[model samples]
Target: MTNSTAKEEILGRIRNAQKIAFSGKDLASSAGVVTGTPGEHFAVPRDYERTSDMPREEVISLADERIADYKADVRRCSAEPAEINEAVKKAVADAGAKIVGIPSGLDKAWVSGLDEGKGEIRVDEGLGVRDLDALDAIVTSSAVTCAETGTIFLDGSPACGRRALTLVPDVHICVVPADSVVYGIPESISRLRDADPTVPITMISGPSATSDIELNRVEGVHGPRTLMVIIAG
Candidate 1:
C-alpha cells in the first residue's frame, strides 16, 4: 500500500482500541471542584490544599547545616579552592576552559581575574541564547540554594540569565552566597510563593547523573557532566 493508505489503516485500528477514561463532570467531582466547567476549576482545587508547614526558623537552620555540609564535603574531597578567585581559576584550568559570565554588572576586576590573565573571555551582557559548541563552561550566581538537597536554584533574571546556558555547557560553575542558601525543598518552595510568575527557574543538584538497570550510575545524562559550586564569602 502507499504511505498515506498504510498510515490510515494503522490509525483506524489504533483509534478503535483507544479509550478516554474520564468525563468532564466525573473528573471535576472526583477532584472536589465545582465550577462552570472542568477546565475552569483547575486552579480552584489547587488553592484549597493545606498551606506549607515549612517553619522560618527551621528553614534557616536547615539552610545553614546544608551549606556547611556542602562546604565541608568539598573541602574533604580536595575539591574546592581556598578563595573565590582561586576556585574560579582552578575550575577553568581544570577543564582547559573559557568563561561565560552572566550579566550582573560583575566588577571588571572580578571578571578579569577569572581569565587568570589569559585575556580570552566573553561577557554575555546582552544575555542572548549562547552557542553550546563554542562554549567550554558557564559561570554565574544562583538566586538561592537548598542545602538539604544540595540543589542550586537559578531564577532567570538579570543576574542568572537563561537556564539554557547552564544546561548546554559541559561544565557549570555556580556561585551562591551563604545568606541566600536555604535548608530544604519545602522552605525553598515557600520562599518562592510570591516570586514573579513570569520568569523560569531551575533547581539543580550535583552533576547530571542517572542509573541503569544494573544500578550502575552514570554522570551527565541530561545536563552538564560536571557541577562545580563556589560559595562566596
Candidate 2:
C-alpha cells in the first residue's frame, strides 16, 4: 500500500511485459519499456470499459444533474446551431453581463444576439490576462464531458479556445454537443486522442473554488467563478 511498494509492483509489471516484447528486448530489461521508436506503439490490453451501456440521453442527464450540484447553471437546447446560440445568449443575458468575450474562432452566430442588444463583444484576438479579466463573461464550446464525474474538457480547439480564455474571465458560458457527452472517465479518455499533445487539456468539474483556506469555500480564485453550461442535442 505504500508508495514504494506500489512503484515496485508497477515496475515489475513492466519488466514482465518487456520480457516477452520483441521491440527492443535489450532496452526492455531495465524499466519494462521497449525502445522509443519515432512512430512505434504497443497496445496494452485493458479490462476497463471503453463504451457505456447507458443510453446517451441518460448520460447527458447525469452530467446535467452532477454539474448542477456544483452550483453551476445547466440547461438543454436543441442541437441546431441557432438554438445553441440562442441558449448562449440567454445565459449571458441572465448574468446581466455587459461585456462578453469570445475566442477568435467562436461561431459568430453565438454572439449575434449580444450585438442586436446593447451587449459589447470582445474577441480574443491575442488578448492577454488583463484583457480577458476585464471581460464580464466568456462564451466557449466544449470538447468532451464525463457524465459520471460531471466533468467537462476543453482542449485548445477552434470552438474551445486557448486555456486562458476560459480561465481569466469572471463568467463562462460553454456549449456542449450532446454526442460528445460520455458516461464515464474511461470512455471520455478514449474519445480524446486525435489532438496535439502540446495543446493544454482543462478538466473542470465545477467552477474554480477552494475550501482549503480555513475550510471556507471561495470561488473564482483560480478560474471563472460562474459556469453556465448549455447542452445542445
Candidate 3:
C-alpha cells in the first residue's frame, strides 16, 4: 500500500474508536466522519504519585549528588544564617568575584561577609542587560529544586530577580534551602503552584552547555558557565 493510503486507514480507525467512545455512534456506517465538539472535555486519570518515595534527607542528598554530577559546585552548610553567610562568602572568594550582583530583596546575610571595598555588590533595580553581563557573579535564592532532575526553580520572587539577571551573568550562586528540595518535578510544581501561579518561573538544570555536530562540549553558550549551589538547611 502507498504511504497516503496507510495513513488514511490509521486515522480512520482512530476516528472510529473516538466516535464510539464519545458519541456511542458507529462512524463506519456514516458517509462522513464525526468530529468532536470544540469544548468537549475528557476526564484523564491522574493516579501517579506526585513525588518519589525517597525520604526528605535522601531527596536533599540526591539533589546534591545530581547537581554535582552536572559540574556545578555544591556547598552543604548548617541551617544557621551565619553558616550560610560563610559559605556564600567562600564561594564568591573562590571565584575571585570582584562584582557581585544580587536581587534587591535577597537576604543581606547571604553576602554580608563580603567586603565592599574589595568587591562590589550591586543590588539589581532594573539593571540593563549590559550591566548584568559585566558582573562577575549573581547570587539568588531558589524557590524549589527537584532531586531527580537536579533542577532549580526561580519564580521571580524577591530572592530571584528577573530571569535576565541569572541568564546574563557568567556565574550564578543559588542558595537552596534544604526544605525546598523535593523528590521530583511534580512535587516542585505543586509547591510552586501553591505559592503563586502568575509569577514567572525559570528552571535551571546545570551550567549552560551544548554539544555541536562534532560532539565538542562547550559551556556558557546560553547561560551562566558556573553554577554554585549552596544547600543550606
Candidate 4:
C-alpha cells in the first residue's frame, strides 16, 4: 500500500482506541477493529480542505517566503514573455553559468535573451545523467507549484523535460507561472490529474541537502546544490 494509506490506517487505530476509552465501549474486543489483518483496508475520511480561496497575489507571496526559507533564491517577474526572458537572463548571469540546459517544451521566449555569447543553451533531447552533470545549469518551466509547501512539481511534460534532466544538473532554475501556483498539495495534485501517470512526477521543495548526526548541514548531496526560482505572474 502507499505511504498515505498506511498513515490513515494507523491514525484510524489511534482514534478508535481513544473513542473506546472515552466512551467506555468494548468495541475493540467485540468488533476487532484493532486486530485486523495487516493488509485490511480502513476507510479514511478525507474531508479536509483540498482547495484554496486565497488571492493569487497572496499565494505567490507565500510561495516566495517559503521557498526563500529553504535558502534558495527566489525572484518575481511579470508574466509577459519579455519580462520573463529578462529575469531568466539576469538569473543565469548571476549564477555565472556558462552551459545551460533548456528542456524541450519550454517557451522559447524564456531564453530569447540567452545566446552563445552569454552561454551555451543546450536543448534537452533525452540527455543522460552524465550529459546533464556536465552542464553548468538548467532552466525549465514547472507544471505546478504548491505555495503552502514551497514544492514545485515537474510532471514529465515537454516543458518540464525528463526527471533526470533536473536531477543531475548542478543548478536548477525553475520558472513558475503565478497562476499555476496553488495553495496546497491537494490542489497541486488535482492540477495534474489529467497527465499520464507513467510520466514521472518530481516534487522539489528546495535544493537537495542533508545534515549529519552531528547536525552539520551540507547541500547538493542528492541533487542540484543551487536552486533559483523565477516566479512569473
Pairs that clash in candidate 2: none
Better of 1 and 3 by lDDT: 3
Q: Rate the local accuracy (lDDT) of all candidates.
A: 0.62, 0.87, 0.89, 0.90
Best by lDDT: 4
Worst 10 residues of 3 by lDDT: 28-37
Model 2 global lDDT (CA atoms, 0 to 1) = 0.87
State which candidate, 2 or 3, has the greater lDDT: 3
lDDT of 4 by residue, 90-157 (tens): 99999899899988799998998587575688899978778888899999999899989999999989
Per-residue CA lDDT of candidate 1, range 145-169, in tens? 7766667788776556576777777
Residue 40, model 2, lDDT: 80
Candidate 1 vs candidate 2: the TM-score winner is 2
* Candidate structures ordered by lDDT, highest first: 4, 3, 2, 1
* Cα-based TM-score, every candidate: 0.61, 0.80, 0.83, 0.81
lDDT of 2 by residue, 1-233 (tens): 99999999999999887776756546454777655666788666688677778987788899999999998899999988889888988898898898998888888876786866677998887898788888999999888999999999988887888998989888999988999999999888877897668998999988889997589999999999999999999
Q: Give residue 214's lDDT in candidate 3 (0 to 100).
A: 100
Weakest 10 consecutive residues of candidate 1 by summed lDDT: 72-81
Q: Which stretches of candidate 1 lie over 4 Å from their true place?
A: 1-83, 99-101, 104-109, 125-130, 193-195
